[model samples]
Target: MAPLSWYIALSASLFVIGLYGVLSRRNVLIVLMCLELMLSAVNINLVAFSFFLSHLGGQIFAIFVITVTAAEVAVALAIVIAYVRHKGSLKIDEISIMNG
Candidate 1:
């Protein structure tokens, strides 16, 4: 069995990579994908801790996180589609809808 520390390290690495992607990328789709990667890292940590502690709470909470992530992705994609239809581009830096 892999050590808990290894799992934590892996999760942390994934999260950092995702954070960098989200921060540095200009494409909205890429940002959304990076957000998913970050959420996946959280899932990995949850599962790892659940296993290490022999408790189901962490696993259950992870399931809720997955559920929320799915809903978030669905809504975000819908928004993305609308944005593309209106603006014809996916660049996050080009968005000015909130400017008033």
Candidate 2:
């Protein structure tokens, strides 16, 4: 069995990469994907700790997180598609409702 620290390290790395992508990327689609990656990293940590603790709460929470993330992605993508159609640009810097 692998140690819990290894799992934690992996999760942290994923989270950091996702955060960097979100902060540095200009494309809205890529930013959404990075946000999903961050959510996945959280789920991994939840499952790993749940397994280590011999408890089901973390696993349950992870499932809930997955469900919510799915809904968020669906809604966000719909909005992104609409925005792309209406604005004609996917760049984050180009998107703003307050300017209109």
Candidate 3:
């Protein structure tokens, strides 16, 4: 079996990449995708630890997180679509126009 450290390192790497993408990207859709990537990293950590500990708590919490993520994606995408229709582009720099 692969070691727990390997899973942790992989998760951490993905999380850092996602964090960087979210911070550095100027595209709204890309930022949202990076946010999802970060969430996926969290799920990986949760599942890995759950397996190591032989406990259901982490697994259950991961499920709740997944549910919340799905809802968030639905709502966020709706907002993004509306915003794109108004702005005519997906650049995050232009998002400030909505900061009323």
Candidate 4:
């Protein structure tokens, strides 16, 4: 069996990679995917801790996070679709019409 520390390290690495993607990506879809990756990393940490600590609160929080992430993805995709319709591209730099 893997150690708890291994789980934590993996989760942290995922989070860092997600952060990097979010920061560096210029495409809206890629950015949203990176955000999802970050959320998944958080879920991983929560699940790992819940397992190690034998606590239900972490699991509950993870559920809430999943719910919120679903909502966010719905809203973000809607916005992205709208933006694409207006701008004809998903690139962040090209959709600067709202830069007021």
lDDT of each: 0.97, 0.96, 0.94, 0.91
Ranking by lDDT, best first?
1, 2, 3, 4
Q: Could you tell me which residue pairs clash in candidate 3?
A: none
Predicted structure with the largest lDDT when compared to the true one: 1
Model 4: lDDT equals: 0.91
Query: What TM-score does candidate 4 reach?
Result: 0.93
RMSD of each: 0.7, 1.0, 1.1, 1.1
Q: Which ten residues in a row have the lowest lDDT in candidate 4?
A: 91-100
Error of 2 at 21 (Å): 0.1
* CA lDDT, candidate 2, residue 3: 99
lDDT of 2 by residue, 1-100 (tens): 9999999999999999999999999999999999999999999999999999999999999999999999999999999999888989999988978797
- In order of listing, the candidates' clash counts read 0, 0, 0, 0
lDDT of 3: 0.94
Q: Write out the backbone clash pairs for model 4.
A: none
Which of 2 and 3 is the better model by lDDT?
2
- lDDT score, candidate 3, position 5: 97
Best-matching candidate per TM-score: 1
CA displacement after TM-score superposition, residue 7 of candidate 1 (Å): 0.2
Off by over 4 Å in 2: none
